[model samples]
Target: MCTFRMASNSNQMPRLDLHKDSKKLSRAQLDYMRIIEQQNLERVRRLAKQRSNNIMVGCLLGFGVLGIYGYSIYSVKQEKFLDELD
Candidate 1:
């Protein structure tokens, strides 16, 4: 079990044992670990969202390029046909 004592001097920081093993961590250390874990989880979620957005943008750009290529081919075919008729 963890124990805490209030400091008599207002300017002094509370003493804590932060060097203990994980199984014997103090209350303050436990709270700190929880905060770190939550932050890491948030970071992972943000990275995943960014990756999905990049994939979507790439797919859209690829389709746009394909459409432009198809249109150019069709235009060339029409020009060839007109030349043959002349």
Candidate 2:
């Protein structure tokens, strides 16, 4: 178990003065933000693709295992019936 304590000032958070004559962002800032956002989006897409691929691989493996098990059962039954006829 874990416990957390809140500070007294946490209730009354300080407000940011956005219009306090802040410095303007140069073209470099925009370019940097664009690149960061692009990379983040790419990462998300890659993760989604990997998840789908993993799911597909798992399904294929499950079917393969089931097929092998079913074939073994069928072959055993067939051999038993043939032996009985003999």
Candidate 3:
């Protein structure tokens, strides 16, 4: 009877249940999230304002350069027209 024990040959691995114990957030956690979200929105607004002002300044400078270029071309053309009439 001592030499009649059977040998086991099992190779199965244990499985884990991922969702067996999940906890919900408390009210204070939610309030903190809301405050963080509000700060993010304010930051976005400030960045947008800065972007718009930068675009406006760029447009003004562009127009100033184009105005000078156009005036120079116009003066040259007027001078050529006057010379042609001579």
Candidate 4:
């Protein structure tokens, strides 16, 4: 019986084998790492939500400006202020 000390599969994708450290780490370290990962995930979600809100506000503001501009154009067309000179 023998071993090549490496995977013999040619089509298999190689990946990081961090499970080796699982046995070496104590409970406290594992818990701390889990907490850090969770915090990072939460921070990412918060930033994503804020970004969506900002985009929504910006879109509403832009539409408001466009609507006002359109109304001004319509009002100007309805009046004969410029036509009086012609």
Candidate 5:
């Protein structure tokens, strides 16, 4: 018997399993399942790549902001020290 189940996550693809009799599935059914699986695999890969890129961009922005903040603090302290010398 061929059984199809929905994944726990609604965003994910359905899960298909062949149970009891492997030979019972028709050629068309097998072909359809194969196509769906391939599509899902491609979607997963694309999503993963996008997520990695987002993280990289976020980290770069965070570092840039921190650098700017640190530089401003250092400049303020330097000015204060120079003022005290005069």
Candidate 6:
């Protein structure tokens, strides 16, 4: 029960024991480990891509808003509205 877990990130890998005589995994267990590792890798890759996209979008929106504010001030200055007050 991870209280701070992210909803989209969930992964579980089962524990397996090696063969006592061989000191290695059986053929099926090895295959299972490979498959699980591949799945986990794919999940990691997908999550990384998603995170990069989110960061890019957030940065673009943040910078765009800042640019908008800067332009607003520049346009207002061009109007000389404040000149009337002074």
What lDDT does each candidate get? 0.87, 0.82, 0.80, 0.89, 0.88, 0.83
lDDT of 5 by residue, 1-86 (tens): 99999558978855545875448779998899889999999999999999999999999999999999999999887776767798
Put down candidate 3 lDDT per residue, 1-86, tens digits, no spaces. Answer: 36776565477544434355223556776688779999999999999999999999999999999999999999887776766787
4 or 5, greater by TM-score: 4
In candidate 3, which residue pairs get closer than 3 Å at backbone N, Cα or C atoms, i.e. clash? none
- Candidate number with greatest TM-score: 4
Global fold similarity of model 6 (TM-score): 0.62
The list of candidate 6 runs beyond 4 A from truth reads 1-24, 81-86
Q: What are the TM-scores, per candidate, against the unseen true structure?
A: 0.66, 0.63, 0.55, 0.71, 0.68, 0.62
Q: Model 1: per-residue lDDT, tens digit, 1-86?
A: 99999659988866655565566776887998889999999999999999999999999999999999999999887776766787
Instruction: Name the regions of candidate 1 deviating beyond 4 angstroms.
Output: 1-23, 81-86
Candidates sorted on TM-score, descending: 4, 5, 1, 2, 6, 3
What does candidate 3 score on TM?
Answer: 0.55
Candidate 5, residue 34: CA error in Å?
Answer: 0.3
Selected candidate, larger lDDT, 1 vs 6: 1
Q: Judge candidate 3 at residue 60 and give its lDDT.
A: 100
Off by over 4 Å in 2: 1-24, 81-86
> lDDT, candidate 2, residue 57?
100
Q: Which tens-of-lDDT digit does each residue in 1-86 have in candidate 6?
A: 55685455347554455544335657786788789999999999999999999999999999999999999999887996778898
- Ordered list by lDDT, greatest first: 4, 5, 1, 6, 2, 3
True-structure lDDT of candidate 6: 0.83
Total colliding residue pairs, candidate 1:
0
Which residue pairs in candidate 1 have backbone atoms (N, alpha carbon, C) closer than 3 angstroms, thus clashing?
none
Alpha-carbon deviation at 1 in model 3, angstroms: 67
